[model samples]
Target chain A: MTDSPPREPRRLTRGEWLVIAAPAAWIALFFLAPFALIVKISLSRPAQARPPYEPVFDLASGVAGLLEKISQLGFDAYRGLAEDTLYLDSYLSSLTTAGIATLVALVAAYPFALAIARAPQKWRPILIGFAVAPFWTSFLIRVYAWIALLKDEGIINHALMSLGVIDAPLPMFATRGAVIVGIVYSYLPFMLLPLYAAIEGQDPSLREAAADLGASPRQVFLRVTLPLSKRGIVAGVLLVFIPAVGEFVIPDLLGGSDTLMIGRSLWNDFFANRDWPAASAAAVALLALLLVPILLYERAQTREGRR
Target chain B: MSARVLRNATLALGFAFLYGPIAILTAMSFNASRLVTVWGGFSTKWYSALVHDERMLQAATISLSAAALSALIATFNGLLAALALARFGAFRGRSLFAGSLYAPLVLPEVVFGLGLLLVFVALDVERGFVTLVLAHAAFTMCFATVMIHAALKDCDPTLEEAAADLGATPLRAFILVTLPLIAPSVVSAYLLAFTLSLDDFVIASFTTGPGATTLPMRIYSQVRLGVSPEVNAISTLLLGFVALILTASALLTRGRAKGGGAG
Candidate 1:
């Protein structure tokens, strides 16, 4: 690199303080405080009425009691979650569904990201904008479109009947397959966007250098392009997987009773069942599961950012 | 594989998959039939009915105000955070601070929404438009930060230094030099915040008080009631509004950059 000025540390003045304070304070109160609040509620017993958390124990109860109490938070919710087979089943199902959805999305989006990376400069924006088209509409509308298509006598059936492909109209809606389709349809862009950014950032010169050295196209791609884009793959998976894990809308609309995911369970506990503490616990546990990706993504971005 | 063939097929397929359903919905919005998803002929009858729907109209106005207000607050906070992040890297706890802002972006909306609902309840704050706006601004800041940080990381600091050398104060230099150069990201960030707020349902559901419903909440309620072509009409109109904003922005940038050769 190009380095002109000698490196020196400079203290931040009042101006810098002014720049950072507002955003920090806002995030602290609303974002961070609420997470702490949920964690607190998760430790408490279920509330039947308004403000549905009761503290597990006061701090003055002693360090031993507090630690034991904090650890019991999971079991407290788990006991309730297990007793209600629906809640437990949904949690497990959502995890599997989200995992499968992420796998499908990665398979689908990778080649597209590669294509966009190698696209002609002139058509790039047009293609990219098209990639972003789904995001331009309301999320509910997109899911509804799937509903329109996947209903038993919906457009898919209509098209298939006209073509005389099946003797019976296939049952497409309210199935695992339909739910997966909805998840993939909604998250396809999320997978593509990061993968595109990462793949595009990889220098094209490396591929040329590999070719110049008499490497075959497949060898160059497998050995060079794929490895270089692993970071993108990770980022893509994370982006798709985390949200898919907590997906409520698609499952709520398209999924059958068997498609019990954690999100819908959490939704029911609070809204339908009116078990606030258990709901808060399920939600917190979901948040805890999500924290893994959130923390990982933050760490990766920060690490990448420093360079 | 040949890059041209590979790219063409991938681009065409990807675009079709992404945009195809949306196009269908848009077309059906104007379908001159009682069947919502079935095709018959084209007319604007659904759109006309959408305008007359009092509930949807009220929700739209509420959503617009919420989006605009939250976006303004998010932009202000995001710009400053980006500035501090890009310039003042000397501070300890920078990553921690950044993480706090960025956490909401990655945390599931279900979790974040639940957490915020708890916080509001704990604080005994009434959940309504005010609560909705506060929560929206809080989480939307993550998007603003990401957009601006991406822009700032690529920006050359030499421009600011040059401005400073020419007798500009740090504040003046940033206003005159840095802001103008990075304004595209600001617009992009604002656009992102707008969409996130406009599309927010989970958070709004948790925090929005009675009768302070936004469009997504309204639509979700309507969907639970039953699917209707009226939803399609409302969606089509909203889509058109976003498209218009993006088009105007592009044209404005084009005119401003006239023959500037990618400055």
Candidate 2:
């Protein structure tokens, strides 16, 4: 063995500091800055002019002028969300819709994940490939793919009618069911991958022990498997739920006007009404609603890291 | 026996549910007929048509370049963040940095999009390719950080130490030893960021300026107008490209695994 050079003690170096500063600055400017801007914009009033929102603070003005400007930034937009039944309904509907979609995704993915986990060891990679292949495609295109199959004159309807299953094509497109299907379709991988990892990593001997003890496979699964996979279940739930809550593309492409997801409402508030402040306020409100789940996930992750 | 049959059936049905719609799209891409449900004999006319479409071609260019640039920047910065978080012990504001790094993972695209747009507007900066790159980089960086940080955490510190003991400088040891060992993570992080940037619709939709339409934005507009076989052709090509890349990478990883264990 070669003689070793002098081993240096652990210390934070200037080079490391400089390297860290790059990403830190990027995150601050691009991530935190926008969040701060959203809060500021939500407080300001929507304007008729360019950029479409009043400035909350103008440095060109002195301290007294700044105070006046700050006071001018009111809660009109938040009040708008509270006062409008449409906005209130949209919020409520988004929650219910997202919640339902998450449940649907979980139900569908659980068995799929379980099946993959239980599959022959040699086939596991191929099975996972099948599950993840679709995710590699464009998300928008995947939703569009459903449209061709779900439309009145689309493949599903045409095939069903040809088979004399129904006299007229069933109304499948532009409904809540369609929206939920879209969400489930797009998010299935998110749910399945985590659950598969959890299940696959489980101690096989526990199942063997249960089998040796004459416990039914069903009983063993219900008690040993389900409880063991709870962490993955929670992870899959949060992954599906958080994005589903603010989902825009699926509801827009698949759900009818009755869908009323806050994502679509946020889109309309900004693009259609050009109410920047109102849109900002709606986003902030949605973030606030999602904070509980986000915090829970954060805590869960920390706890998982500890484990 | 019935339970075995049931388990197999569940697997079949699950695969069907996942692959059915995608199969329809891929099949339709080859149809000679322009109709949504009808299949006249197979033809490649739409694929040829896609090549001739200027707007679509331009949008594809914008998308490819943007994804490349965004993925590159994100991978670099993310590698740095990963190093800082995983290797460095507790530092002041480390928790805040970590939290902020991860917030983008769960933040709604609409909120982030709207917020970024507002920030750009307030700054009076042009919202175009630069802004798109910035937004994509910011979000994808979080994903990259998670990946590389995990790799770094699992990395054998003793290797780098051994390299230093062999008279390599700290930076040299990192460059020569640690970087090669974690190269797979870096490559995967880049691919992840690239795919995300390529597949992104919402954030790009919010942040893009006129004449800077990405492929997803182009597809979104064409789709909103009506279903066309050309869109199917493009989707097929995109799907085929991604499938090829992923298969190659998967095989590469498998080969590497068999040759030598991952660092």
Candidate 3:
């Protein structure tokens, strides 16, 4: 965007080096190294010990020993994950729950995003700010709030009972429906913000032109507004879906035992079973599964930014 | 007119769904009934009980300290990373650094927490406050970097160049001219980091050691048993605290903008 003159190629100064080195090294060591370690552990045998896995590499072992230890890494964890129906079921359930939650969030957030986008200019900022305010409140507490309202004797059931809507309090706590509610409530903002941006940035003239051409409001939205906001819809879905898929807290707190999610299983492996290799394998598998959506989201973001 | 009415109705219902549970929880906090579902009457008994709860107090202290320390450290490093990405022209391995920095944002907490815990175990680094701070700072730094990078992108580059042209060193130019312009975002970055750390449970569950349970972890344990009015009390207080800070900052910014506009 700038027409500034190109500067001569010069070596970076110590100050510049200082600026780059710290965060670069920190991320490399802490973030990248840990991820690499998880991959390494996932390839190893689960051993009952302090580390909970046979070391993928032993520095004490010399050249031949190093080669043997390197060869020791196998696909046992992957095989176990594949062979176990529990693991497979958890993965499937996690995907289904996340998928359903994402769709619900999209439906709920679209109207809110459209409202904020089409609101008067004077009220836009305040309305958007209020929309985002609840997110700042603790996420866990928000989920917990549902327990108070969703339990058999909870507010919803109590209100329903009092109004003679039912003879008994409905079973709502620790149900799949409760889990979906928790997911939707917590992730509504993630969907709305992106949708609002997409909808708001759209040209009003196109919509007006459609309306002027005798297109119905619903027709105009489906043809123009919806198509135009496709980027936001994609972004919002991925944002809600990816996190929901691997979410540990929501499913654990709000879901029944029957509501098996890969996150909860992974946590169980790590803490309850103390099986680091298996847990690492679950994490690796989860990441591998999410790789496509993550890459797609990033590409969408970059393309949007370029525009 | 019907279309407008439909839009407004949709908006009102959306807001109601979003805020309903929170409003109920806040109201429940003040209920005299010990049971969460039963609202006997209005009272501050739960708040008084929350005040005397020693475990909650300790967890609150640990969470606040870790959040404060992590936010400060992350903000500093994040500002540097933002400068490296935004101001400094593309350098060697810039893409790699950028990718690694942003990887944490989408990475599931299970992956990150397990990986980091493995690292600490491999390194034989004891898990405690130090570990929590390190992990929190690492992830929160990414968020801070993103926020500051956006702010820097919007700022005029010439402002820094002007300062440099007026006999200031590059560092001085950044500190004197560029930093002021992005100060609001920097503050926001810190707030974001703080809240993220404070609210984090999954990672804290994995990384925390003996006697280092965070407030979220505490709340998680209590919530698992069932809804306790005490949990509501604490949640309400925390909610109030967040609301106060946000509203105050919003008003402060609005007042400043009005003053500037008048001037």
List clashing residue pairs in candidate 1: A90-A260
| Candidate 1's TM-score | 0.90
Top lDDT: which candidate number? 2
**What does candidate 1's lDDT look like per residue over B46-139, in tens digits?**
8888878898899999999999999889989998888887888656556567767777867777778888888788778998998898889888
What value does the lDDT take at residue A296 in candidate 1?
76
Over A243-275, each residue of candidate 3 has an lDDT whose tens digit, in order, gives: 999999998888999889999999999899988
Model 1 alpha-carbon drift over 4 Å, by segment: A1-12, A55-75, A203-205, A208-216, B1-6, B162-167, B248-263
Q: What shift in Å separates residue B165 of candidate 1 from its native position after superposition?
A: 4.5
Per-residue lDDT tens digits for candidate 1, residues A142-241, read 8877877777777788888879998688999889888888999998888888888878888889999999999999999899989998888888888888
Task: Show what share of the native A-B interface contacts model 2 retains.
Answer: 0.71
Q: DockQ, per-model, please?
A: 0.55, 0.54, 0.59
- After superposition, the stretches of candidate 2 with alpha carbons farther than 4 Å from their true spots are A1-12, A60-62, B259-263
| Docking band of candidate 1 | medium
Q: What is the full ranking by DockQ, best candidate first?
A: 3, 1, 2
Fnat of model 1, as a fraction: 0.65
Model 2, residue A208: distance off in Å is 2.1
Across all candidates, what is each one's fraction of true contacts kept?
A: 0.65, 0.71, 0.67
